[model samples]
Target: MLAMIEDRALHTDLALERPVPALQAISHDPSLRTTVALRDGRRLTGVQAQWAYLEQAAAWVDDRFGADADADTVEVLQRWESVLTRLERDPMECAREARLGRQAALLNGFRDREGLPWDAPRLGLIDLQYSDVRPEKGLYHRLLARDRIERVVTDAQAADAVEQPPEDTRAYFRGRCLAKYGQDVAAASWDSVIFDLPGRDSLQRVPMLEPLRGGRDSVGDLIDASDTAADLMAALAAR
Candidate 1:
């Protein structure tokens, strides 16, 4: 059934006859073929990608046995590395074959050797566990607590990111506006923020066409000087 669907997709929307430049680039770029990405927007590829897989598998072994991990984890890592190394030879083609129903990308052969049959329900359960977002219940957070998942940023850094937008981007200006005068803001989009002020006949739309223009350095003092949204608008108009 999957193969038939894959065939349909390949011959239709994803057909080689109709080439998308970005997709074509991804096919050729090994760095873009990462199966895992970090929260700090870093891609795991090459040795880093292999190491990530090993780290997860090793952590699982440690979790189960609570023993010296070196020996117990080595065999599993070797198997995973073997599979990943082979896949990396032609990652895009490997992915295509897997999608087009090639019996789960050589892992099925290893499972057969181990006398373990394919288990769709078990796979689905694992997927569900990973996606669970509750910190106490999620598989990922559990691993995170154990320091199994690699940390790209400190807890404080992540918390700070949640509270504030990047200072270098136009989001700083937009975020400051929302934080200060969100009640007056009727609507907002990427390119503009619309304000519905008191005693105003029409909505005031502030254009944000230049992403680099509205950063902290550009508008921080202006925003600081304005007492209200109306004052800010007037100051902008005078400029």
Candidate 2:
């Protein structure tokens, strides 16, 4: 965003005034080494597409701004390159990560060089627009309502997700714990949950390091039968 803005403001004739061509060329390449399926049945191709885009953008920045460019530009680009390179080990994951979402404001800002002045306030508004959570007010929600954006999950599924966790994941157990004993949970993470049970000498840290274990199918009955978190712990320990 900064690069393009500065590019226009200074009349620098660098390539990629808009990222459309670069994104399109990479994504639609016939010789793509990898492809990943989106939930909407679309396929994303190109393993190093994002890495290449960033590299191109970095070059543009260097050419247009020279020493006036941000000091961390190279470092940020390098970091993105490193991450993308590592992701290439899994082509599907790499392809999925390469997918980028953009807002109308951003595209308009890029094209309306004369209208939306390349300034801090405009940039900040564009950057922070998505952070608005209200469905009626948020720019993202408005786009969603207009079907300008694709959804990975439907509204019904999302609503159900609020009250239920996946039956096949360890999240089921964690969700059950929260539902039955949220008051006892002091902290929770992907691999563990800390329980601060009353009358206990110390907090009990339950390690859920096994990602494949503790699903609803494996522990639903046990959880349903247990009256308290301690009872559930005892039942789990018995297993």
lDDT of 2 by residue, 1-239 (tens): 46456555433233443356545666554334544543444445444445546666777777777778666776666667765665556423332223232443443455487465545476667557666888877767766677665555789999999999888878998898899989888988999888897789999988888877879889999989999888887887898
Top of the candidates by lDDT: 2
Q: How many clashing residue pairs, candidate 1?
A: 0
Model 1: pairs clashing at backbone N, Cα or C within 3 Å: none
TM-scores, one per candidate: 0.54, 0.56
Q: Could you report the Cα RMSD, in angstroms, for every candidate shown? A: 15.9, 17.4
Candidate 1 Cα deviation (angstroms), residue 67: 46
Stretches of model 2 off by over 4 angstroms after superposition: 1-101, 104-106, 109-114
TM-score of 2: 0.56
Tens-digit lDDT track of model 1 for 162-213: 7687777778878888888889999888888899999999999998987677
lDDT per prediction? 0.62, 0.67
Full-model lDDT, candidate 1: 0.62
Best by TM-score: 2
lDDT of 1 at 34: 32
